[model samples]
Target: MADFDYDLFVIGGGSGGVRAARTAAATGARVALAEESRMGGTCVIRGCVPKKLMVFASDYADLAEDAKAYGWDAEIGTFDWPRFRGKLHAELDRLEKVYRSMLEKSDVEVFDSRARLADAHSVELADGVRKTAKHILIATGGHPFRPDMPCADLGLVSNDLFLMEELPKNVLIIGGGYIACEFACILNGLGVDVTLYHRGGQILRGFDEEARGLVAEMIADSGVSIHTGTNIVEMKLADEVDVETGTISNSDAALGAPAKNDSTSLGENPKSETRQKAGKRIWVKSTTGREGTFDHVIFATGRRPSTADMGLEDVGVELGRSGEIVVDEYSQSTVPSIYAIGDVTSRLELTPVAIREGMAFVETVFKGNRTPVDHELVPSAVFTRPELGTIGLTEEEASERGEIEVYCTSFRPMRQAFIDKPARTLLKLIVDRETRVILGCHIVADEAGEMIQLVGIAVKAGMTKEQFDRTCAVHPTISEEIVTMREPVRAG
Candidate 1:
């Protein structure tokens, strides 16, 4: 396939790639897009789409319990793992087909193989086929990483977790990030014994502090054993010959601490690091000398841009110190004709952000419009037990720049109070004291993500606190707290 005739070639037919390719092609530019795996990338296939579905499914478990209080005699429920998995797979399959059809209808040349840089303006396919274009775009996304522990290979990564043959009985998730938090909710909701271990005081560390505290409280109350400030030092697979190995898998106790070593019992038998190749038990030692075993282990650590094996360096595309491609305001790479968008550029990892960036890139170059991506006030959500959503600055952050008035509210959610669930929803607003502008708005509660979407629009439009106050309150709604807050809880 030595066809070298195109104006723009996008690598990786994920969200950004498809958006850019379709947009560019619509503007009378010859476009080619190559994707090795399923279209729609991580979000549609494995990450956001399936994960959010799981989150919605998980929330039902609590809702079922809460239903009894609402005068419905809901039976103690059992989750059908196979049914849920089948439904998720079917939905993903439909989406994949839709993405394919959309690209085909747009007249964008689609390659069903991985695209690697053959030269600055040319890319070679996995089968040694080559194609050339005036511009090359890299939209390859990221993958989850599992560290090298004794039995690290035995556990599953993010993509692997989605494709599990069957649901786990007891799952031990190793990570403190948002991914870890979301997975804990999934497994626990599915009736799996889930123990989450993170080497930090809180999960979702970068989010607002109050949001972190509220999620921690809600998740623990929902039956998840949230272990913070703990690290998994070593992992040993289950069903090993050594009898003492089983004790090393306990969750509450630290595994790797020097004091916990039973020197007398082992008789110097080479420290028993053996693991069963097929079965699920993993012996892990943490920084706190905690040892635990679980039926399955999931590594929800983090991700890096999927730029490897694609030959970015060969194409002379400049990458940041973090290995992300350097893209300008218009998402153009250092190479004048080449451009990059989405996670590969490390600008914003959200699916919507990638779509917007891809559209902006197409608008600037193809449509002859000078459009620049502004990433300042995009809002995001985390789907943990008590969901988290925030946009704009934190109270401390806004105050650090200048004197600000902080309005804070914490109260038991009306529904939870009646159900005897001891969970509280938190809301805080940082308003500039001089301008009365709402500098930031943050919320940590049920439907926090859903609530923050509207708040994000207000923040992006630079809405002031006075405007928020002037807006009529929607009575009996939690979100109306933003408009109804009477006084600053703290002023500095």
Candidate 2:
């Protein structure tokens, strides 16, 4: 223990790294963690935490309308992005401090710099310092990826959204993923004209078909113009007609011409005045042959694991095609002395899953107990306008496995019904006919995320359809629909 600087060295200060560091330290292991950026990683700094706060901010418009429906004369004023962004940053700073203090209390040494593998058992920090450890854990997480295309640099990724000075007057979001849909709803709710373009026919391709359908309808109804089977072909800066008048010239010509690499591109300096002006009115042509100008273009296409240039390949650590570090059930990489967890592994991108993998790593390495992370039946929620909360198999997946029954209900909820609002909710259950077990539970409505969590417990415990049938229903509530559906709406 004295020979090595740390018993365990964790790279990346995300959820997985933090949990492993703190837990391993608690077991009397000398643990050190290195994070290049913020302590909270993606979930805390850029991904889930800040995104959820934005979701809440956007929902106020609907809430105000609901309030008016309930006879409480209510109105929604303009969203104060500056005030909300300030509070959001403050809260995030406080959270990061809490993580730091937790690690400090646990005696975990933290390095606020980039870290990479020096070898199987050594980590090199950005400060030209190299440290040795008996074991190294990588939990570097992931970063948003923009598809390669002409003038693609002009578009913004998910990370850029958090740093914007103010919301754009109009925005064009590219992609059909949850991130794109979520932001579309968010901007639309905040009074921004949002248009979403996806090459696919529907949004959220992996979720339960019925659930995603409901969510898509809800999002479109919320004022987001969604264009399916569409993608950006080219993007260029709007031509200036008069610099003094701040007028754009020949927007149509700008959209028609092949995008030319110019000094005003975001690759130069996105914060510069030229770049800001270029972003204000981006002329874009789409695969569908539509040409238009938007205040901003956001690409939520996908995210890639943050494993590049981390010396993993140099150290002979095996990585998959997507650059994710391949790991066993025990979170052990091919290199015996090294391991990985979290989004970097691409096992399951949820924060809770990463935290669990971290705990398993600590138990397996520090406590001399073999613990394999479980990756089945995890519940997750997408913070779209009306969130989609789901667990276990989708209806398509369940049907392919075996004979199954699907029970689902979609209707305007009591709250929305009172106001004659078009907003609707869906509660669905998928059951395996052979074992009578509830194979899946999916919800599409307000607080769907919260509802699916409780449902996840039942599914995780191997609860049967009959068991769900036996439980008493909570009346006058949306979730009661989950327990009250007596007959299977569809069976095979």
Candidate 3:
């Protein structure tokens, strides 16, 4: 065996990278992991952890009203954003510490620099330090992408959402994906006048149409102005557009935009730095020919694997068109010594999926047991109001393959109905007609995310429609509807 510094050198300190480093180290492998920025990567620092906290904070907006509906005397006061933001940052700092501490205990050497492939067996850090390892794992994850426009720099990506000093009063969120919808709900609940525009005809594309359509209705009811098939084609600082005719206030014009994202051509646009700040109000014209000015514009268009300028290709590692590391079932890249997982691979972008891939990598490389990361029948949830939880194929996807039956029900649940809230619940099961096996389960309701998890187990096990019917219904629960719906609402 050739002598190397580390048995495994992990690039990226995100969930998958951290977990792989820790697990490999636990097996007595000399693991070394590098992180360019924070210790906890996206999930802990910018993505899931902080975003879920924001979701929790946003959920409280309805608490006082829901309490009143249940006959409790309560009224919501103004939300103190500064106080909440301070605490949020503190909590995130604490979590990052936890991630670092765990790695320390794992006996893994840590590098606080951006590391990339110098060769199949050698890794290069940002400071030009070169380290050799028997195996290299890339877990750099993905980043939110922006449309290429002159002033597209003005829009905020999902990562920027967590670092805000204060929330915007009126915000325009671009795109129809989960990030956009979730933030629309989050900001709307936080008392921001929220406007959302998507170039697509509906929000939450690639999901079940009926479910996402209902989510759209519920989001609108929450006070978000959603416009589908719309996109921002023109944007600039209000002063640049026409200060006298624009919505730019004298004080607002004086306030510069917060510096975030990549450095654009400061020479091309002198005020570009100040013009694209998070706090600055932007004048925008949408594809629909509507013109408006808003406190902030967010681009939730899509995310690409963060594989840029990493020398993956330079070392003969194959990358897909979207810059994702093309990995095999075992997460091994074209170069045998180099492997990748998580959003960087762009197979499945969920944090849990990334962690699973990391586990599989360790098993394959370290344990002498080649394990393939399973990507089938995975459950996912969108944390919008009346959350959408789904596993397996969508109704649209399943029917095209073979004979199928769809049993779907949408109704206002007891709690919401009692309170006279208009929010409704949707539970759908897509079953194969030939063998009666349940192919998919989808839920759209409060705690829909929670519901799909258990349902995923059943679907993954290939439980049949008869089997679901055989199971006893949980009394007075919305999920029980899934079991009690005996006949197919429609079959083809």
List the candidates ranked by TM-score, beginning with the highest. 3, 2, 1
Between candidates 2 and 3, which one is better according to lDDT?
Answer: 3
Q: Show where candidate 3 strays beyond 4 Å.
A: 239-279
Per-residue lDDT of model 2, residues 1-492, tens digit only: 448988999998888899989999998999899988788988988889989999888878777777876889888788888898899889989999999999999999989988889898899889899999999999999877667675566677777777676778989999999899999988898899999999999999999899999999999988899999999887776643342355444554343432222212112235323456554467788998988777778888887888888999999899999899999999999999999999999889999999999999988988989999999999999999799999999999998988999999999988778788898999999999889999999999999999999999999999998898899988889999888998999986
**Residue-wise C-alpha lDDT for candidate 1, range 233-272, written one tens digit per residue:** 7775444444254344443322322321110110121222
Worst 10 residues of 2 by lDDT: 258-267
Instruction: Give residue 14's error in model 1 in angstroms.
Output: 1.0
lDDT of 3 by residue, 1-492 (tens): 899998999998889999999999999999999998888877888888888888898999999999999999999999888888889889988988999999999998999988878999999999999999999999998877677776676667777776566667888999899989999999898999999999889999999888899999999988999999898887766654455565654444443444333312112233433544533467788998998887778888888888888899999999999888998999999999999999988898999999999999999999999999999999999999979999999899999999999999999999989999998999999999999999888899999999999999999999999999999999999999989998789986
Q: lDDT of each structure?
A: 0.79, 0.86, 0.86
Better of 1 and 2 by lDDT: 2
Give residue 167's lDDT in candidate 1 (0 to 100).
Answer: 71
- Cα RMSD (angstroms) for every candidate in the order listed: 6.8, 3.7, 3.7
TM agreement with the true structure for every prediction = 0.91, 0.93, 0.94
lDDT value, candidate 2, whole model: 0.86
Clash pairs for candidate 3: 257-277, 258-277
By lDDT: ranked, best first: 3, 2, 1
